[model samples]
Target chain A: MIEVRNLCKHYGARKAVDDISFTVNDGEIVGFLGPNGAGKTTTIRILTCYHPATSGSARVAGFDVLSQSIQVRRHVGYLPETVPLYPEMRVREFLRFRGKLRGLARGERETCIARVTERCWLGEVVDRPISQLSKGYRQRVGLADALLHNPRVLILDEPTVGLDPTQIRETRSLIRELTRDHTVILSSHILPEVEATCGRIVIINRGRVVASGTPQELRSRRGDGAVHAEVRAPVEEALQAVRELANGAKVTADAADGWTRLRVEATGDLREPIYRLSTQRGWTLRELRRDAGSLEDFFVRIVAEAQMQAPQ
Target chain B: MRATVAIMQRELLSMFCTPIGYVVIAGFLLILGVLVILTEGFEPGQPATLRNAFGLMPFILAFVVPAIAMRALSEEYRSGTIEGMMTAPISDAQLVLGKFLGSAAFYAVMLGTSLVYPILMQVYGSPDWGAVLSTYIGLLLIGLFFLSVSIFTSSFSSNQIIAWITASVVLASFAVGGFLLVRHVGGFWRQLIQRANVMGRFEESALGLFTTGSVVCFGALAGLFLFLTIKVVESRRWR
Candidate 1:
């Protein structure tokens, strides 16, 4: 469980993490979605107590990150962006070192290392030096280090950043499995990955929380029954006919490669009306499909537009 | 405290795990051994003493310790591993002291190898065993001070090259005290500058004087640098 309120980190006049706040319930997997320099890492750093918040409070597992950082650190395992690893250390040794730092006893340290090694699929490379491991294995080694102590909460920054597709999927599944027991908060710029992995998302733009909800909830709320249609007709003629026929429907139109494309936002589904109109007008309806509202679409529409306006 | 020990142990293992430790130790011993032998050949009646061995170490440490300590905290910053280490359940003081002690312990081992010089002298001629032992104590203290300085410099920059250069400059300033450049200064200014002679303190201690002042001076120098290193590391988290 984690709580953050009015968290702001300012480097002189620039606000790396402006007024951002969110909470995660026990056993919940929350994705922190943002673009580059969107203060996702700054917010995570504050929660992990790696940096003091300029003016805010963050609590982890009922312990205040500022006043009780040691306790908070005891409960949370953080895998920072770039995966901080000592190159000369072996995977097993690194995990054991992390276990001890988390205050596990000798036998417990070994047991924890073994458990995480198996869980994160690091057994084969356990004896290999970190420098010798590939990017995916090194990333897993970082994950194993974080999971070694069996902490109640996991904060991972870009957990699957550079992994191959297979490794990414495996890590996503591993993260999903982690939620069966521990609270998870991970930051990523990959929208589909977050949608596939996280139960809820806190979308940040320009160092501020612009939207927060489940993936479907955000998609549906931002939706107004919009559909993208590609008609095989003269661009102006197609636009004129659609605009005149659909009386009150709003359309954002564009043409590419001689195909007339229009994004129509209607109060209700207009597939049947558009199909009838195309038939009557002898217009070839090349593609007429309801736009599948995805997290990527929702994210780009909201945060990207917001950033363009404010320049923060 | 436990976390600090964990970090210290890992660092110790890492030093030996790589060739960094072996190279520094081997290079130091070989050069110091040859220096001792060269001095014996040059001044046959001057009596072989660790004074010559310890005398050259400040120059050796000017480079060797920097190589060892350049990556202490700098590598963590460069690789972004400091985030993991700092966010662990340990206080800044513990991390600082643990790293300081770990590197100091390595320096101790490096200094330990030079004991062969004193032992060789004792076998060949009658050297002052007290002075020889005292000189070694002085060298260890100087090594610790240099290690602390290098570590502190390492904390200031993520680039190892920058850390090494900064540490070299700081150590050189201290090592080049009263003798080298002070003659260029006025009498009063020269005396003031002489007080900056860190190695001069070792010279007194090596004379078998056992002055509490010299020990205190080296202790304070190490303490100051260690404190500065901690402050630099802590500042990075907030900014």
Candidate 2:
């Protein structure tokens, strides 16, 4: 489990991570969603003990990030944004070196190396130098390096920032599989990537959290229910009836080839009301449905809203 | 300590894994050989001593030691591997000490190869084993001093060339640069300059002199730089 409270990191006079607070429970796969320069990387670095916060506190795996940083580091596996790696060393060599640095004994190092190699699909390229591997393979090697010690928390910064679609799919599946053993906290700007992979999402803008919830919850909370209806009644009557039910919802109606099409947009689910109204009016009901707004739109809107509230 | 050794091995691994390590050793040995031969260290008529060889170190080490130590931390910074290294369970002291020891060990090997000269001299001339041992010990101590300064400078920038230049300029101030001011000044200032002079200490110790004061002085300076490097590294976490 990871708990962060009022975490602030400043570089000179600029606030990189400005008083952000959140938590990730055990067996949870959380996505840190943010735009560029939104302090995603800075927060990750602080959590990994790469840098200390200017004020506030963070604890990882029951150890404080500042006072118990060594213990925190021991339990944390970090894959940085750029996938920092030694280019000359072979995959196995690099893993062994990292395992040794992580204080793994000889036998444990080899076994850990083998386990990660197998888990991360690094078996075929274990003998090749890191420079020779493709970008996807290099990313896997970085992930393998992080997994060498079986850390309690796996913190990945933009785990799939640069990859082909197929590789992205593969990596997403691998991350999902890893959620069984590790409390995974990954940061990404890609909306669908997080929507598809993570169980919970924390969206940040201007170094502060704009919103946090599951993908379904964020969509439902931000995007009120809008119903689309097709009725054989007159366009004016259909519009008035839906407008009366919607009570200030943006209702529109138009007649197209003998059918009145009505749209009712409001803060709550209006589909059932529209269906009952269409059936009671003795009109032939044709179509009634609602489209859930994509997380992309919600992400853009909240981030823009946050920006307007606190102008930089 | 185990982490320190692990880092030291990685340091050595990076150095020897490239051709630069071999090239440097060969070049330093060849240059030292030519310089010793050009002087009369092996001449039958001259005294059988290694004073001339040890005398050349401050000048050569002012260039070569930094060349060897320049990339230790600088490359890690430039390549972004420092993020990985700093986040590991090891302390900053282990990281700094490991890199310093690795470069010093490489210097030991480079300096060890030059022992061929005394062996050749032993074929006919009775080279003073006391001066030989003291000279080697003195050079290694100075090498530690040089490696610490160079590694400290390596932490100053991500550019290896900049690190090399910074280390060279700082070391030159003690080895050669300080002498220019020492001649013009008198009394305490000159005494202070002479007291910390690397070339002067090596020259004195090259004549079979191994005083506790000399060891303490060089050892303290090396320790100071190592401590400073650790501080600079630790400061990164704050920034």
- Candidate 2 runs further than 4 Å off: A229-248, A254-261, A267-288, B40-50, B123-126
Which lDDT tens digits does candidate 1 get at residues A110-215? 8888888899988789999999999999999888888887889999999999999999999999999999989999999999989999999999988899999998
For model 2 chain B, give the 10-residue run with minimal summed lDDT: B49-58
The lDDT, on a scale of 0 to 1, for candidate 1 is 0.84
Clashing pairs in 2: none
| DockQ, model 1, C-alpha based | 0.68
lDDT of 1 at B71: 77
TM-scores of the candidates are: 0.87, 0.93
CAPRI class of candidate 1: medium
* Candidates in order: C-alpha RMSD to true structure: 4.6, 2.5
DockQ of each: 0.68, 0.69
Assess the local accuracy of residue A286 in candidate 1 as a C-alpha lDDT between 0 and 100. 85
Model 1: how far is A169 from its true place, Å? Answer: 1.1
Cα RMSD of predicted structure 1: 4.6
Scored by lDDT, the top model is 2
